[model samples]
Target: MSQTHSGTDATGAPVNAPEHVIVIGGGISGLAAAHRLAGAGVRVTLLEASSRLGGKLYADEIAGVPVDLGAESLLARRPEATGLAREVGLGDDLEPPAVLGAALWTRGKLRPMPKGHVMGVPGDLGPLASSGVLSAAGLARLPLDHVLPRTDIGDDVAVGAFVAARLGHEVVDRLVEPLLGGVYAGNAYEISLRAAVPQLFAAMREGRSLIEAARGIQRRAAASAGGGPVFNGIRGGVGRLPLAVAEACRALGVTIETDTAVRELRRTPHGWQVVLDGRALAADAVVLAAPAPVAARLLAAESPAAAAELGGVEYASMALVTMAYRRRDMTRLPYSSGFLVPPVDGRTIKASTFSGRKWGWLGEAGGDTFVLRTSVGRHGDEADLAWDDTDLVRLSREDLEAAVGLRAAPVAARVTRWDAGLPQYPVGHLDKVARIREQVAKLPGLALCGAVYEGVGIPACIASGQRAAADILPGIVAAGS
Candidate 1:
């Protein structure tokens, strides 16, 4: 057990005690934070309200074969996620997608996704026009972006509104919304330009047209990235990442407890007192890695200002319906990884991923069985989620039949619903995050991290955790001396 002291020296200075840090929440973010703190030789205790770890990254069996029911891939371009995977002994298991490129299911057909676009804001109109993704009038109006006056993006603006003004509604509705939806599960018209796509926002601030900005971004990426795979996954499942991280933390002597809810948090003269159901734990520092609402409730009495800001952060709910089928039952397989559906098409499902085709391991493991999954629900359009699991699977099959001529029945099906899965970023979300951080910083030994901050991606969440660990380390080091 770590030594806990609650007194001051003769000079009124805080008495030194061995650093004991507590991390609330057992998601990837919390695990990452605990790993970092433990690596620094601090005695750390991680508490989770749930029975299991890996909040959004979960793996399960479908038809006697392992499959990822939650997040299946990681952005290979980002180092945080991939780097963490390597650190946790998954270095050799990292596998890139077997297939690449996807189609956009719009206009009653599947059109090849156009090249040279930043989140579907076309840089080269030639491919966009040839792709048949837009109507004649929409194609003609695209050039108007070059002639429009510079719109004042005072503090922040909506991604859809800015792109619609510079291009037109067709572009935002057909391309931007669907692409952004895949990431945020929120309407582009409501998402923040500054928070969602900072690079595009920066380019626009320099007086360049959206087209030029997108082209430049593509060119720079091509030159610097050397055409590496955009995404990567583990051989078994990306969901195994958090489990591996937790194991590494345990090896380092970090204490992790699940099904343990933290009821209250109070600041002590020396550090903090974390109140639970029957007892309390003392720590030199605390990392709040819970979701926004949970964090708000825990911090209400300690930091009301920060709690209010966290309370304002909204979230989007979603579900993934996974199904497995016999390969012989299908007449043809999807050529690419998958396709994204535009909401304007009035589809029940938002997107589908051909797991067997996308992941080489899954294909080889399944042998005669083919697997695929479809996502349902979004920010404001979650009525579909109210349906039961069987209904969601049925609705998914109905759309799959229309989108890809998939009429065969599956051998097994599973529905994984992530209620409030992703955090939504409104117009001034970045500014709001800054205020929340400022308020938390005022309280010594308190720091925050999660999808509610900079981003919702796996890498972003890991980076957020690392940042929180770094923030409180200095205080812990000083008190230990």
Candidate 2:
């Protein structure tokens, strides 16, 4: 017999509903799952081991100003993040990054980042040379990619190998390293092209030179449709995204608990048994929306195979040093958004975001204080985190003085360190995810979703959570029936 129950949609529209769902993880993904379930009229309970609801979507008041301590922006193209915002009454609050270009700081000089490039692959030669990003030899070697025959890429390859082979190491070091670093905080040589930049990989498979493919991809993006900022942020900060989602979940009758750690998960004759704060909770379905390690631990006894595969996933840690300076304290600030430093330069800071110039909202609230944040450390490069917060601020100031010519000491400085901040998506990560998913699927009412399994961006995580929630709903219905 098919079971049918009524529940309301995100917009309060009524629809069929499932039974209760236990979401283990209160981050954006977990919260999204709970929200979607409640919208569909399913009972949901969200447990967060930490005191806060947002995992990495952290925000705090610094110098009497509300600022995002974690992610600051969401990719607008991915409708997941933006769509959720609208459902939660955050649509009007959506803001875009200022229409200002950023630069690369390297070679003891601030160079203009090339305008036409696919993740640092030059689509136009003119900008590449004029930007001073590459040496004379590097510039000369770029053209070689046009004439070289197509290289064979098996199933998958590292992003660095594919790009370096066609454009030489200079392009990878000067261009790709910094750009990829800004996103993954991992080495290009180890990051998967298919996973990280799928469009670039698909274009490369067309049996054309990497340079031409990159240009074609860029041309497509340009010729597509309306032009707008690629990313969107909340008026205050992206940190509010999770808060709004949690509130929406509660409005839908979802029970959300914080400071409650799920110590264990066991498969019961009835859905599953969740051990949390020494109490057992029953659920018709379970959604594991946590980091790889935590998920691995929870699933270890139930499914050792899945645990082993997930344990292999590695992570990278980093720290964000945010500083505020009085406008009068600095002689001048750069006209553009900010800059990135390649790993090859051995700089302590990897990238900087000119918050005041990039986000008009922050600037308006900041008044005379110009705010920006510098990222430090990456995969296999985390010695900077060992230094005290004061030293980290000092080193960041020194780098800024050289790169941006800032001599003013910051009136407010805060350092937020994220241990295991990013998960490394090495080659064949997709395959591993597939295997893990298959094993977990064998047990009805169990589903997994997170950055480790899918894309790392906020939108991707939301999509994964929604998809997982949808997948498990059928099982919930069937079990109850």
Candidate 3:
């Protein structure tokens, strides 16, 4: 860990150092990079623009309990994030969701998420047949997917179009759209299917029928030991994971400077020059792990091609309202994790999670306390995100009352707003990403990684960071040799 005011090498040499690296952005990606570099014996400095670390990994105490305002959970099957956790000695802290149940708010009622439905696409017909979430007519409409002819268009297509074409409009509007729409805060009509759900696309390309593909997957899993475990989170809160990562990085002697924003990056003859607080720091390698737009601005003058492509990626704004109330105030607590509301419902909220029921530790035996997390916003409804705290809470409360029978005032309430947080993978996102990668590869001693490229979840961010670290460390080692 080195921070030189004069931007010179350790030997006080005015020349460029062989193994000096600077990682911009102190989020999960930046932390992962700095930690990896330090572990590999590379001198690294991580710079963050915010007053505190964890850009979108924010957590604060509410009513004496930790509440996550940003990312809350990680899919266990995503090895990158979970692998990082284990490496950082936080593996034991991981816990699966107490209750695997979830609901869908439809037709002005709360309905359980159809069992055996992987992310809203039915894997088994039995669950869909038994699920009251959809009518028998809607369930019958799903079999149409088997007969749907394959389309050979070699261009990006919206998720909505793909779902509607393969399945029925009811499946898209009632099942797939709202569930996925809430996750991305994006419009299925515009979001790219390749970028959003590549696995489903691959299944379609390979099996010709989603039902057949899903059945094949089930058979394979049953024949084997079993499929991967469902999603999991930290026992305390999702914030603990980042906190542990940051701590591990610090323990490895990585210098983390929060509130130090990197304004620009310039290519020098030997290495790179980074501008921050009107001061410049020179390093052998630089990693831009910030948001796509921020990264674009930093590299605009240095790599115009990369910057242009990065700037083209779009992001959507979203808001979360977590409220705590007495369980007795509600009509009945469903044995479900949470519920997703379809956009066609014209409701103010996109989805609502039964925080207390989602996990066992979150609730008590015969206790009356319950916490609910409600999300608001999508591509067309950006205005909802712009609402002030008062209005936001009011709107969320109104939706809660209609979705779940909540009448009592919340004992606790908090609102978190993210401007341009959720990345929208519009049609052709992969092509643009390819171009960006090509331009990035042309630049020596520079790497780019973040949620905008591979995935939007924590696991993807960690994977991106680790991959960047892997790329930068070898150069450092060879330079030192």
TM-score of 2: 0.95
Clashes of 1: 0
Q: Give the TM-scores of the predictions, in the order they appear.
A: 0.95, 0.95, 0.90
lDDT by residue (241-340, candidate 2, tens digit) is 8999999998899998888888999998767899987689988789999899999999999999999999999999999999988867755778888999
Report RMSD for candidate 3.
5.2
Off by over 4 Å in 3: 1-18, 135-140, 153-155, 218-228, 327-331, 364-369, 475-481
Worst 10 residues of 3 by lDDT: 472-481
Candidate order by decreasing lDDT = 1, 2, 3
> Model-by-model lDDT, in order?
0.89, 0.86, 0.76
- Scored against the true structure, residue 473 in model 2 reaches a CA lDDT of 64
Which tens-of-lDDT digit does each residue in 106-146 have in candidate 1?
A: 99988999888999888888899899999999998999988
Candidate 1 has what TM-score? 0.95
Candidate 3, position 251, lDDT: 86
Say what the RMSD of model 1 is: 3.9
